[model samples]
Target: MTRTEELFLALRQQIVEGKIPHGHKISEPELANQFQVSRSTLRDALARLKSIGLLVSQPNVGYSVISLSTEHLMEIFYVREALEGMACRLAASNITQEQLQNLRDLLESHESSVQLKSGVAYIQEERDLDFHFVIVQASHNPMLIDLLCEKLYFLVRMYRYQFGMVSDRAKRAFFEHQHIVHALSVGDGELAEFLMRRHISASRDNVERNLLVNKGVIS
Candidate 1:
C-alpha cells in the first residue's frame, strides 16, 4: 500500500477501535511527527477519515473525531431498522444460492467464534462475519447497499467498539439469524423483512435499556 493508504488504515483502526477518544481534536503536526509522514500525506489520511464519517473538519478548528451520542445512536439504529428490513425483503427475492451459502458459512463461523469466546458475540471484531453486511449485499440494491454498507455500517461498528457492545441475546440472535436466512431461502420476502426489523429493533431496545441503566435513569 501507498503511504497515504497505510496511514489511513492505521488511523482508521485506532479511531474505530476507540483508541483515540471521541471528539478528540486531531493535531496535524503531532500526527505527522508521530507517524513520520509529510504534511501532505497526513492531510490525505485525515481527508480519508473524514470521508468515512470518523472525523469531522471545520474551517478553522481543524479536525475532531466524530463523537456519537445516545440520540445519534438511536437515530442510526432507527434508520438501519427500516433500511435493512427493506434490504432483507429484497434479498429474499434477489439472493442467489451462492450468497445463501456464503451467509450460512458466515453463521457457522460465528457460531464457532461465539463458542470459543465463551459465548461472547464475535460480530464486533470480524468484518467478514458481519451478518448485516452480508445480508445487505444480497439485497442487490445499489442505493441501499451504498447507504448501509458505505455510509452507516461503520458508524454502527464505531458505536459497538466504543461501548464494548455485546448483545445479551447472543443465543437468541443466532436463532433469529437462522430464521431470517430460512425465510430468504424460501423467498418469503414479508417474513424476512419482519424478522429483520424485529431483530434490529431488539438490538436498539437493548442498547437503550443499557444506556438508561448506566445513567441510573432506571434501577
Candidate 2:
C-alpha cells in the first residue's frame, strides 16, 4: 500500500478502537514521526480520514477525533439501512455459488472465533466486515460498493466502541447473520432482503439502547 494509505489505516485503527479517544486532538508532527512519514504524507492520510467523517479538520486548531452525537448516529443508521438493504437485494439476484460458499466459510470462521472466546477486536471486526463485503461485491454494482466502503469505516469505529454495551450482542449478531445467509443460500431474494433489513435495524435499536444506558436515560 502507499505510505498515505498505510498512515490512514493506522490512524483510523487507533481512532476506531478508542485509543485516540473522542474529542482528542491529533498532532500532525507527532503522527508523521510515529508513522515515519513526512508531514505531507500524513496530511494526505488525515484528509482521507476527514472525508470519511472520522476526523474533523479546523482552520487553525488542527484535527480532532469526530465525536458521535445521537443525531449523527441516527444519520449513520439511516444511510446504512438504505445502502445495505439495496446491497442485499442485488446480491440475492447476482450471488453465485462460489460467493455463497465464501460467505459460509466466513461464517464458520466467525463461529469458531466466538466459541473460542477470542478477544481480538480487529479479528472479530474484520470477520464481520468480510460477511457484508462479500454481499456488497456480489451486488456487482461498483457505485454501491464504493459508497458502502466509505460509510463502513465510520460505522466500524462506532460499532466497535458500542460492542460491549449490549449483552451477548455478538452472539445474537452471529445468528442473525446465519439467518440472512440461509435465505441467500436458498435463492430467496425477498426473504434475504427482509432478514438483512431486520439485522441492521436491530443493530440500530441496540446502539440506541446503549446510548441511552450510557446517558442514564434508560434503566
Candidate 3:
C-alpha cells in the first residue's frame, strides 16, 4: 500500500479497535507527528475514516470518534439486515464449494473453542468475523462487498467490541452462524436470507436490551 493508504489503515484500525476510545478528540498535528507523516496525509487518512462515520469533523471542534447510541445501533443493524441478508441469499447461489468448506472449517474451529469455553475470546470473535466476511464476499456483488466489508463491517465490530460479548452470547452466535452456513451450503437462497436476517436482528436486539439494562431502563 502507498503511504497514504498505509496511514489510513493504521489510524482506522486503532479507531475500530477502540485503542483511541470513543469520542476522543483527534489532534491532527500530534497525529501527523506520531505517524511521521505530513499534515496533508494525516488529513487524508482522517477524512477517509470520517467518510465511514467512524469520526466526525466539525469546524473549530476538529475530529472526535463517533459514539454508538442505542438508536444508532438499531439504525446500523437495519441496514445490515438488508445488505447482509441479500448477500447471504446471493451467496447461497454464488458461493463456491471451496468457500463453503472454508466456512465449515471456520465453524469447526469455533466449535472447538466453544467446547473449550474459549468461544468468547477476542480471537474467536475475529474468527467469527472471518466467517461472515467470506459469505459477504461470496455474494459476488462489488457494491455489496464494498458497503459491508469496507464500511459498515468495521462499525459493527466497533459496537460489538465496545458493548461486550459474553461467553453465552458468543456461543449462541456461533450456533446461529452454523445454521446460516448450512443454508448456504445447501444452496437455499431464501433460507439463507431468512436465517441471516434473523441473525443480524438478534444481534441488534441483544445490543438494545443490554444498553437499556445498563441505563436502568429495563430489567
Instruction: State candidate 1's TM-score.
Output: 0.91
Off by over 4 Å in 1: 114-124, 216-219
Local lDDT at 216 for model 3: 40
lDDT-wise, the better of 1 and 3 is: 1
Candidates' lDDT values, in order? 0.86, 0.75, 0.81
Candidate 3, residue 98: Cα displacement in angstroms equals 1.4
Error in Å for residue 147 of model 1: 1.7
**RMSD in angstroms between candidate 2 and the native structure over all alpha carbons:** 3.6
Q: Kindly list the per-residue Cα lDDT of model 1 for residues 1-219, writing each as its tens digit.
A: 999999998998898787887889999999999999999999999998888788999999999999878988899989999999999999999999999998998878777774435655546344446889989999999999988987677777888887874656777788889999999999999999999999999988988988887883212
Q: Candidate 2, which ten residues in sequence have the lowest lDDT sum?
A: 115-124
Candidate 1 local lDDT, residue 167: 58
* C-alpha lDDT (0 to 100) for residue 183 of candidate 2: 83
lDDT of 3 at 170: 71
Candidate 2 lDDT over residue span 17-122, tens digit each: 7788767899988887777999999989889888877889789899998875676777777887878878888888889898988889888877777442543222
The sequence of per-residue lDDT tens digits that candidate 3 reaches over residues 1-219 is 878899988887898778988888998888989989998888888899987789998899999989767778788889989999999999999998888888898788767764436655423455234777888999999999989887787887787676665634676787789999989988999999999999888877877776766794312
Of the candidates shown, which would achieve the greatest TM-score relative to the real structure?
A: 1
